[model samples]
Target: MHPKKVQKLIYFVFCCLFTLPVLAQNRVVTGRVTDAKDNSPLIGVSVVAAGSATGTATDVSGNYRITVPASATSVVFTYIGYTRKQVTITGTTLNVTMDAAGTALNEVLVVGYGTVRKKDATGAVQKVNAADFVQGVTTNPLQQLQGKASGVTIATTSGDPNSSPTVRIRGTVSLSGNSDPLYVIDGVVGADIRSVSPNDIASFDVLKDASASAIYGSRAAGGVILVTTKTGKAGTPQITFDAYTAAESPLHLLDFADRTQYLQAYQQFYGKPMPAGTSTTSDQGANTNWFKLITHTGISHNESMGISGGNEKGHYRGSATITISKEMCAHLS
Candidate 1:
């Protein structure tokens, strides 16, 4: 071929290679979240991309703007005390309305060996939803009960993970015979709330007062804690996973005497001569970092996975969860 023809052919090949189409870039998405009943804007609502970490929250005015990958097809909206909603986006501008979450008043509440409605209850009772449990912390479910209900006090005398907290409702009513409430899990008595995984709990109900406690007989004086495990729902199989990892360290440390200072003080106070090879220097021969040698940051992790679904007959649900935590203490000696 002629040189001009060859050059022309090469130029055509390069142009074709460069002309390949490029993927579309993600666009800015904006929207407003509001309550379905009142038409009032919802503020500080969490708007997240489904199955991903990309998300943002609604501003004080209930307005939200987020940049999502072009591949995102759906987004999830959630707020406390509100039902979660998922929306498919086709354009930049979206408007959403969320429904109020149903409570025990609309659902069933477990009582002594039976169930009842919240409005008809004649006892001092409190209920907590499973969805409200902390996702990734090693703390017990009772720890989350603090400030969640009225007239319920859960105090942790010590920070031991395996230790149970003291739970009191409307003050203690018994002088002995177990001042703590009776724990019932899934219709079984004497259940340890700590043993059951928090992820497995569907709901928790606290029964107080004689009207509610009388059903349990002798076990009622201390009150009652009822736990219900998650059950299956009818529909397509749905899977959910929650994972968390955390590290905790002392924010402040108290200053104390080092080995040399301690030994010197001992000798001076006792009016005894210094040991043969002992030095009075403030800096000990070998740096003894008491805190470093004795203590380290605590680490905790939790993982949970659940599957729910059903056919025409009935629903089936299953879940498993594991959590581990290690806490180290500083040796004052």
Candidate 2:
């Protein structure tokens, strides 16, 4: 053969020798990954061949296929909020069940000046997520947090929707009857909770003991309520709309003396038939239903719109809310 032809033939033989072993050593492994607690398939799980970069991710159905080299003895599976697992390769098919990682204990709490894991925190703290908030037409955000946290009492002075609910932590802590907990919004001390719409709230971290005093001073004597509003998330821009309407009316009315009953009572007290034409400001001779005349069905509505989105570097969110409420008491025209 010619010198150039001989060189080309040798190069082709070397390429085959190097590629054949790699192709033969690689094997395809397939399996499904699921949650151990509920046995639900877990999507987006990362599956990597042990000791090699060869890896793949579980699809929407939680099924995965990876090319494992002969040098790899196992495969690693990892996902957020789940325990990492590794399985020895015994055959072409491998199934894995992943247990949930520490949920409550592993929660990252937003405390004063920093974050602390719930398991490490020594103070009496409770967290209420947005998903757990009360649903209804609410004029105040605190109303949404009612009955969600322990050691917290939330009540309104009346049934009027305009009135803000009073929040007390561990009952009345003051002689002045002002048991409002200190409001901390996004690291701003004494921020007004009303400024943030209920639909914009992300979560509430309530510090319900004397330990809170160390952070916000005596103002937190009743307790400390840390409010974290929703912010933009890393994803496509999202627009959300929330609205609710409530109708209010008195369930029962007090039974009072009507014209006939009042006349009979008067006659009984006087021990004779009352004189006729005894028309006075009190005796208008009209059996008017004062309860019906003074009250009517009231309506309350709340509507909110928000938009949020961002990338890994930063995010932004903005929202607006409109609320209209009317009391049951009818106005005499």
Candidate 3:
């Protein structure tokens, strides 16, 4: 054998040794997600192979690609507002359409110490989230859970921006101490609801009956409000920005009288003469809309920024938010 030929064959053998392992790990799965009802592409659907730790999420166009272990037998897909779907592995490409789980019986609910399926909970607990929150510009988290939760009453005695709403569970338990439900935000025993941003909340659960509230012991006589925040997962870095702008006019603007209407009403009843130089135009002078004068459009601007990322070792997430609101009422003093 020639030395030059032997060296060429050795180089070829080295290349084949390294390429075999790379080709063995080339098992890939690709798919698209869509809405079951409309056939619309669904983005951000989480896809994970059952027997493997590797996972991936769909893109904006509802396309997903993930690498699975050779021994994997199934894949599971999940989204926040959709039903979970698991399919047996038979081929390389698997497309899925998720149905809207409006009445989510299998949905998970947080209880005293842990979580349970919504249908499995034996206690009287009502859950509220962004989808079911009371529609309004609410500075307090309790406002979102108001009226939706039976036996739960909320009262805002003072219109203070920083003031927390007084929550009473099934009315007052006792005449003393002004019955207020125990506040538990992100597992903090006595956390204040005012400190938590409404947009950052993932779930607001009310434990109304004894079965659910018993976990808190005697302190839960008035019931309990369990608040859970969002969490991070192992995935690519995700950043979110949210801006809220609210324009509010008086709710009962027509219920009150305008400047001209007020003048006429006074002249009709008491027969009082009109004040001199009281101009009469809708936009100017005395004819101004009294409702608009005493109350302007309430405007508030909110901004929030959050970032999350993680790996197999651990996950992390953090966010910050700022809100500025202008009072609509004018000082009469």
Candidate 4:
């Protein structure tokens, strides 16, 4: 072919390459984060692109907006005290609901060294699901158990995150010996439930009877608390992501005594007169709203990503999670 004809062919090829479909790949995803059990909106939750580190947080109304590159395929969602979820984006918005860490309690419970359906349980066992243990943001899993389960009482002697609660089952059966029930995780006896992340748990079972406790022998004298973590199921390789953000504040505040009120009360109770010319009104001190000063609607966020895929030989599933909470106001009125 002539040189001019060859040059024309090269230009045509370049034009074709430039004109070919640009890989239909841009997307924008929007969604709201909510509690799976109650469907309550979770504000300030975090949402992110898996493996890319790109992310955004929910607003006060549980709404979130994110723009992903054409190469992006999946997004992860997470919040404190809730299971993380992963989702693939096909449309413009993806509404997500996150189950509380332990809400699956009644669905499954531990029996001896094995597991059984909660409904088929033969002994008197109280089951607490993940939701029962997670409500707002909590660092300690034991705190979530307080007042949530029947026949179980958890008391916090000190307001410390790492401290274990004084757990009692059906009142104190022993006076001097250990009163707390035996904690088991998976098949291991005497396990600390706190060691496992709240988001990692699938369910919790409480064995509370002599017949139920007999299997473990002496270890079950105080009853038993069983914990089960999440696992993979039979299927093709799949990815799931869940994220959420929430703004938390004190539920209520107490009334405070003003300077005048304090001085009058002090004078009446202690028989001490007010200092000369020290007008209570003059030194009323700034009307400090202690509650407002100590409380804040800080943002709490969480994200979880999981991948599962295998063949007939075997299966595998791996998951990772991240949770973050902004500093909160600690003072009440």
Among these predicted structures, which one has the highest TM-score?
A: 2
lDDT agreement with native, every candidate = 0.79, 0.87, 0.83, 0.76
Residue 16 of model 3 has an lDDT of 99
Best by lDDT: 2
At residue 179, what lDDT does model 2 achieve? 79
- Colliding residue pairs in candidate 2: none
- Name the regions of candidate 2 deviating beyond 4 angstroms: 1-105, 158-162, 266-286
lDDT (tens digit, per residue) of candidate 3 on 48-130: 99867889999999999999887778899999978889998788899898999877557787888788988789998888876
Considering lDDT, where higher is better, how would the candidates rank from best to worst? 2, 3, 1, 4
Q: In angstroms, give how far residue 325 of model 3 lies from its true place.
A: 0.9
Per-model TM values vs. the true structure: 0.55, 0.64, 0.55, 0.51
**What are the clashing pairs of model 3?**
none
Candidate 1, which segments miss by more than 4 Å at Cα? Answer: 1-110, 113-117, 131-136, 157-163, 258-289, 330-333
**Candidate 1 on 167-208: residue-level lDDT in tens?**
987788767657788888888888788887666677788887
Scored by Cα lDDT, where does model 1 land?
Answer: 0.79
* Local lDDT at 103 for model 4: 59
Question: What's model 2's overall lDDT?
Answer: 0.87
